[model samples]
Target: CPPIGLESHRIDDDQLLASSMLRHGLGAQRGRLNMQAGTNEDDFYDGAWCAEDDGRTHWLEGDTRRTTKFTGVITQGRDSQIHEDFVTSFYVGFSNDSQNWVMYSNGYEEMMFYGNVDKDTPVLTEFPEPVVARYIRIYPQRWNGSLCLRLEVLGCPLSSVSSYYAQQNEVTSTDNLDFRHHSYKDMRQLMKVVNEECPTITRIYNIGKSSRGLKIYAMEVSDNPGEHETGEPEFRYTAGLHGNEVLGRELLLLLLQFLCREFQAGNSRVRNLVTQTRIHIVPSLNPDGYELASQAGSELGNWALGHWTEEGYDLFENFPDLASALWAAEERKLVPHKFPNHHIPIPEHYLAEDTMVAVETRAIMAWMDKNPFVLGANLQGGEKLVSYPFDTARPLSETLAAAPRPPDYEDDHPELQETPDHAIFRWLAISYASAHLTMSETFRGGCHTQDVTDAMGIVQGAKWHPRAGSMNDFSYLHTNCLELSVYLGCDKFPHESELQQEWENNKESLLTFMEQVHRGIKGLVRDQQGEPIANATIVVGGINHNVKTAASGDYWRILNPGEYRVWARAEGYNPSVKTCSVFYDIGATQCDFVLARSNWKRIREIMAMNGNRPI
Candidate 1:
């Protein structure tokens, strides 16, 4: 029940306003003096490099006697940090601790706001409503250059801050901070609480270390945590790949709590998911970024902050692009492929295929290898839609001939390379958006190309903004795992108060999305002798991805209700391909395969031809 919601502003970029500002006495303070609530990057100022909004501007015009409304205000001057030109494009906003005033669903708190797009004009912000609050907060947001500015809040006080402290105390209480952002350190403490409370269904473990050697932690939630369960499908909800995107990390921690609480309370739906599936949640994959991001929002806004990993590499970019030409040159021949039939090397320079992946990415890759995750959603921020692969089809290589590439399945255009599972991906994506309260509707503003209606709130990754070397693509292609880049919203890091609402917004969708892991084909891969195939590759036809069987000879691949041709193969064994029919709304279909040794024929003759074929 949040988003005290107020939006829209008027801008007055009149340069003559500078001399007029001397008539009013107000000099804005340098960065915040205290690390107050709502003082972080997520709440007010975002970085200039982003396509999204940025910083705050606060000003106080000459003191007013009576409660009055503000009509107009002017910019005072520029402060710290600057572009080479000493000019920048920016949108300024206002905020104050005096009263809640209004908050946007996007999570920004402000009264009236405005800014300029060029260095030439002095900024003048006019308001529709009177500045009634004794204190006026004017901050800059969504700028392309420069940092820090001095502005005037042109208004009279129609409001008072007499009860500000009391209200602040109430809002800052532990109960109101339910979905508060958790630091890497806070996560550890949370994991300890989870282990203490749900000793049986949940377990906390360290998967590996990131670049800064921060222990990348995971929360295992299942009836049998940390242990392999035969025939049970495994699902993962990975968040915080971009440390600056904090909501996913918070939601995951809450989700962990949801499972433990609901399961203990005998909630049937949760009981089933927990009992029949193994779920893993890595809260903060980039702890170093999380820390930097945390600082970016607080009074410590001067810190060198960002979403990249500690070593300065985008975590998502660090993964190996198995579809790239570099992979073809180095490891393609070694790793067999099953789909698109033609094995064309993804152009060598495609993304960072040749460069070493960041330590964090490698850790995730290793952890993924140890489990059979049928379905997953990589929680990220920056948009408010569910996106599916193939994030990219061809490399950004100069050698890439202009002739429409291999994915010419549609228009003879290479840019339209849809994944083999495009149909199913679309369905699953719609399922999430439809379940969302507002996401199903259309949004038209900054960032995306069009209002999201034709495809609903779901989008194709490459189509929206063709990115390279994404975690979703790598996981889907190499592991045969299905992962959706779930963009929670535009604010990568929102105020803590907005986090709970975010969790609620995505909760139902989250559950329904995870349930998708149970819609495809799942079973065991055993040898003719009935022995387990510890790590056999299971590839679903038409889909370029594969799911490997676990140590218990079990594998799971979730797909939308449909028929699929499944092929299971292991080292030194004859391959087995079978057809399986999956129905709508039905549970997973079980299809087991028995592979015979490639040398079984020679052995059969050596042992005096067997009387019958081994079952």
Candidate 2:
């Protein structure tokens, strides 16, 4: 016949015959019956099978044992061939024991292949119902001389393959430039992104809503979640209190982004602050006002007065009750209907009420009540200056005398009495005056109180209401927290171009102002035993500054630098006095006393007793 002979050969029975023929003439000349030509027949051989006398035994390695899954090399040997005439087919048999095997070929048609092949072919099989295959036989029938067989079985389970792909696609996306702007929506979105990215360090809270119904968000940036629960000293920075002051709003947003970035990069100072102290930020307090102001020019069709009405009264004037009245009067004279439309008496609308008297004030008050360690500043603008407390009117208890003494009519002095409650208003007035300076640029007017008042009246359409419900007053009176009102001045409404210059001019002064406030609070006088001594007298003789401590042993005094006598006295002891010299920029002083008993009175009593005793 041709090289395609041997139609009568039985593949299973001809093993020895083929080996013998391969070594002899017919097999040697044809290279052992051209076993490479029958390499494709190996696909039917079940490569893992070992032939015994009666049957073939097949096994799989790995997790496939005792399971009907035949898992090993599925693609058989590397060098097997298939003839074009005889189609290649494979049959797999399963058995629970070493004997009595059953063919699974009928139900799993996918387990068989019928195509001409060259090279070792995989015995394709379906993962049907799992069977414990103690033996599997792969039979190839009706193969030409060129056909050969081999088999490969898989040993890995299906679930592991699925799991690998499942995990391969789950990487989080990272894009830079994510938080470069101050858009409210962008900020909110960035916060969400940050929270997701850094779950261990960040949390956000919705404080309330702005007047325009937009969500007013306050982000509590901290490392420890417990910090919020502990009610620790919280530093709060609120921007855009006046809707038109847009730079602060933008700056606050940028600051938040910067903080988040720096924190993620392992900045120690920021990280420590976020963990140790609660940092609260209200980026835009007056969102409604901002939106209105930002859209003013476009909507109103006027660049000179943008959305801001020419008659719109300044919010800074709405401080004390008198100032509020002045503001209301000015508003009535300017845009009578437009002025008070948004000005409500509720605490949130007034800084004094908001910080010291109103509901919003209660929010901060509650915070202060819990955290006595707070130190903060409220930022405002109109004049580039810092104004401390006692802005409204001094409390009635301050006096000029430095020591405890009975009133003398020759001095024309007012009623002076030492009580448990003494006014430190004078102390506050002098301290703030000495520490900070109001802007010196005068508005082309004479330097007289009346002249200034009249000029303000002409511009504002009312007498200057200098004092009102102010936050600084409340901070000094109600809490131990050190707070200051920072008035960042601009010659006119701040424009985008001037913001950098304005900040450059005021940054150092602002920090120094804060430091002074810090030192003043931190360096209060204590007694010799380190206990805060009550009623300790501090006299700044340069400006004739004099004040007494309260029951709490807290005193605040401000005066020019000079040589002065400071004294402390108690009822049972001789008074103590000291002469000391002070210098400018010396923020505070600590002087304590240990007094001895007065001997003059006791000696006089002894002399009187001797006279009575007839000595």
Candidate 3:
């Protein structure tokens, strides 16, 4: 019989019985199994090897060359001309050499993995934890008439920085190339394939539909798929907002593939990221525009046709004009300390039924309202630098006419508005810029000579070029997510041949930015009874801007290293304050709050009936 197999990896533990091996490298040495083969009387006839059913003493085994880490394994039943036999249950064993071996255990005892029930279908069983071994043997305790198997060891070579890099490093670009950009359908298929291959850590979801009724998809990569975990900071990377700017979309797709592959291969850095952070990647926000852009091919057709949505709206500039509203709120404030810098509400006009806001923009707004995302980056093109919010600043007239403001206010730079989290935002921007291949190069001027040259490869968004209703500003003002506008390069749409280099240029930055989600403080706010309190306001002393806890009672705040007082308060609870010392050497500092319910509940109920709330 032949081996019908899927590639996967796994590890084992101690207490093994004596068993003879068939041979090493069953899948690696031999050619691939007939993936399309069925029980055609000749299926797996010559490809599979079977062990003698001598009282369950005989077993099949293979070698991994050197010491290697395994995550799971894929196995198949046999379908030969003479017989149809398969192992229904089996035990896996691992060893450094061929002599002493450890049985794959469920932490309590040896685990018996289920094999294929039929002859052709493949069964995959992943290990509870990663196993390190060179030799892997299968002990079939139970079989369907006979102990026959075909298998493949799924894993990478030895783990090393250089090897990892070498595995991902692509060939140099040339004029004659076979590369082509993925169409909307191709992108969807690619995402689906990734989700299928790495189902444990990936989830495919649709935020909404495009103007042309195309589903706008977003993929989440996390240890716990589909649901957000408490205390874990949520981060997002969105691209293809302007469909003509294709590099960001390609880079994100590449990133999705890379993360899935590396995580399965037992890459520690990637494993930690997947386990600790909830990452959201929206590869194409404007699928309608992308479809138009992709129709243009690599170097022909209208480049400007897909710069916006099918309805001819710039998605970036289609959000609610919250910048003006924020400015207005600030101007009407009785005191400088009472300025509304965080969680600014959307103006009513933008949410009206007859408004011309793009459907994609509204979907994103609703998405933001649901997820407590702490960090985000919007990938774009036409330059090579990272610009952090506020992307929209107070008008020059207002800056000149307003009364005295806070000390951090920059009257001299009216076009640039600094958030209370400016230092942290700048640090995040620099982290990405410095990690990028050429974004921080001082000698290179800019992608296009006319672009602004920043020594740190970063700038304030409004300072670079103010635009109303920018996504960066919208993200900052309307939600807990602080976002940066990352300009990939000068070319809005480059040839597909350049995608490899483009991915290489942005890979490290993408990984680093996701890792930055852990750099700030995060925790939960609960009442005296230990129940989580939703919508609790968390205010850092001396910073007017504040954040609200999610429905899970968890909150994440990105802060620079410093000692400061943090407070968590609910409407009917006594606010609790604590002093936290954030350090540069560690991940987010944990700061939990336990608020006590106020005794004036009856008074609050009376006030509620009167349509009034206590301060």
Candidate 4:
């Protein structure tokens, strides 16, 4: 039986995720998690796995000599925390059994193994929900053979750290609201404007929702807008992962407005970018967090606290980590993660994988799966430097830093643990800094006095500061997308008055960053019938990272405009590789590949399946 709080629809049972990214490490306790409410006073049934009785039960201890845990499942009417897949609270209940026994909840999302069952009473905590007791210890004297303890195991099904609150009403009326910063309603209104005014190059849709059921909108700006332009390199610029860092969100909206106005005026630069590039902009991923942050003056006092999700989880750290995800891939006999110094901080709720990945995160992941993105930037604040992976440290005992590699390690096997595309990454990161008016200059970094002197406004991610499950690292490692962490400002939460200046500061850099997407290899992977092969993997000969084609059999890879060998591979099809030279003047080199299916193959198998320091 499934645990009470573990809802069926809430579970992420995506097989593709299970085979690759997620890959079976999470607890897969399925089918209505059996949970008995604590209102029972019946005799205890030393259940083989769990105890279920009719409201009344007792305990007759048989094995008092050997101490072990007694696992039991209990139900709650409706877990205020888990609303669909999103977890909103960490509330649970515990019994007042004078004598103690350890209890534990199987963490499906995170492995939670902390709590003393003996003296720590769940009744003392945020009570009345379901409580979990960990490290329980039932003394020998406490469990005599006739021991009839009426002590109810006010046990929680799984552990979640979110606090409970009545769901906030959805904000609809923007009558008196400030239109300066785009609120959810304001963003939707703007989305409507672009769709109607610049209908040719703009299309908008909601990718998913926030924990509080607020819609997460995505606006796609391209030449064809809705249709996939075959072989065109797609780029994405995401912002507002940290809600308090409002610069990116506001800038993205402005960019959308700018592109619409420019397209109408036939401006060359904006016309070219919108014409050639499929740019998807998600102004805010954390609408709930942003809502909390927007209340900076009223209810929420701390800006830093407002930066996190409603649950207080760092969105960047919530994705599948490089080390763990790689280990999972290797278990499936696929490629292995080269080097990772540390592990992602374990999640608070061992409840379900659903909670491990917030609803916002899941939405973004799903969006990525549908659209094949080549190069992108995650805009953020708190620092003014462009950073490149590997964000996590090297394994040389935490002593050996990146670069100045020990002579023994080869280029592919970097001792300092730089990514396979280290050269390109370095160049890309440097380009962003160089384009900026101030960031490239000295005294530009944040987070500390020393960080102010980052190497030429650009730094190797791990070298600057080690982060285990950052978005930049996850994008490069998993999807093989080239994503740079672009830190736009030092002040995390600037007032609305500063929005114009911040946009001016980042305008050129943002435009130039998207321009680089054009200098790469782009092509289509298709069957003999000229039908598109979606999700086809594109690999460059020397580079470690790879790119996958879009649903239209389209793929794009950015390079420094030079000679290269590119290979296109998909399931049940012979991989196609070709050699080509990219002209210095020509922006995107075309190198389309026509894949032939293996005799005993099904075509859809290949086509079907699909943040950050600054972000």
Judged by lDDT, which candidate is best?
3
Candidate 2: lDDT of 539? 45
lDDT tens per residue, model 3, 56-78: 76666665445567776667665
Runs with alpha carbons beyond 4 Å of true place in candidate 4: 1-179, 297-303, 324-355, 396-416, 444-447, 452-454, 527-531, 570-573, 596-615
Q: What are the per-residue Cα lDDT tens digits for candidate 2 across 1-615?
A: 011111101111222111122112122112111122222233332212222211222221112223334532232322322222222444455565536757654464535434224332223344455444433444443243422333323332222222453244223323133322245676577667766766676677755554345665666666664254332334556655565555555545545655677688987755655665556666665555566556532112111221121224233333334323433444346423443211123343444533323233334444444443344555654333334443453222333345465766354223321111112322322233233322333232211111232222111111122344555444443444334544444221343433344343433333333333323211234544555555454443333223444444554433334555666554444667776554555344444455555676776688798984634
Instruction: Write candidate 4's Cα lDDT for 495-533 as tens digits.
Output: 454455556656678888888888767777888888889
lDDT, model 2, position 370: 48
lDDT of each model, Cα atoms only?
Answer: 0.61, 0.40, 0.74, 0.57
lDDT string for model 1 (1-615, tens) is 111111000111211121112111111211111111121333223221111113233222222222446565544233223331112323322335333433221345433344545432335545554434333333344343533343333443345424443233222212222466777788899888877878999888888898778898998998888787899888888888887777888888888877777777888999988888888888888888888888755212222245788888888656655545333442344434322322232335533545566777767877877776778888887567888877765543344444565654445345456766788889889888889755764633322123443548888887666667778777776665778878886556655655655666778898988788788788889988899997788878877545677789987776777788899988889999999989897488999999998986677676665555663
For model 3 the local lDDT of residue 142 reads 82
Q: Which segments of model 1 are wrong by more than 4 Å? A: 1-177, 298-304, 326-355, 393-414, 445-449, 452-455, 539-545, 571-577, 597-615
lDDT, candidate 2, equals 0.40
Candidates sorted on TM-score, descending:
1, 3, 4, 2
lDDT of 3: 0.74
lDDT of model 3, residue 327: 73
Better of 2 and 4 by TM-score: 4
Distance (Å) between predicted and true CA of 202, model 1?
0.7
